[model samples]
Target: MTVKEIREKSNAELLNDIETLKAELFNLRFQQATGQLTNPARMREIKKSIARIKTVMTERELSNQD
Candidate 1:
């Protein structure tokens, strides 16, 4: 997901997305550990998306405090 799309989501939606991403990440890791992962690139993409969502969430939190 793009940062623009993430930025447009409400805080609750972002939180939900984060939870979903975390679960997916965990599953990906498990697959990798078993040497059954078909696409290693997906792991990187998910991590970056999670980071983007987190960065946007932090920005919103900081803005609210100002």
Candidate 2:
């Protein structure tokens, strides 16, 4: 997801999205281990998406603290 889209999500929604992405990442790893992953690039994409969400969350937390 783009940063703009991520920024639009509320904190609760962002947390939920992070959880969902982590689950998907876990499943992707399982598929990779079994050599059944059709789209290996998806793993990287998911990881980046998780990072983006976390970045947004951190930004929000810092803003709140200020």
Candidate 3:
């Protein structure tokens, strides 16, 4: 999801999504290890999505602190 959409989601939803994305990432890594992964670029996209989720979570935490 885009950062804007990620930001709009409630904290609970974001947390849940993070878990789901992490599970997908784990599967992607397994596919890569087995050389069964198609579209290698998808790995990068998934990594970026994880980063975006983390970045948004950090931003929310900083905002809460303020």
Q: Among these predicted structures, which one has the highest TM-score? A: 2
Residues 1-66 of candidate 3 have per-residue lDDT tens digits of 799999899889988988888898889899999999887887788789889988998998999998
Each candidate structure's TM-score, on Cα atoms with residue i matched to residue i, is: 0.95, 0.96, 0.89
**Alpha carbon lDDT of each predicted model:** 0.93, 0.95, 0.88
| True-vs-predicted CA distance for residue 24, candidate 3, Å | 0.9
**Model 3 / residue 53 / CA error / Å:** 1.1
Worst 10 residues of 3 by lDDT: 38-47
RMSD of every prediction: 0.7, 0.6, 1.0
Q: Give per-residue CA lDDT, model 2, range 1-66, as digits (tens).
A: 999999999999999999999999999999999999999999999999999999999998999999
Candidate 3 Cα misplacement greater than 4 A, ranges: none
Q: Write the per-residue lDDT of candidate 1 for residues 1-66, one digit (tens) a residue.
A: 998999899989988998999999999999999999999999899899989999999999999999
Task: Arrange candidates, best TM-score first.
Answer: 2, 1, 3
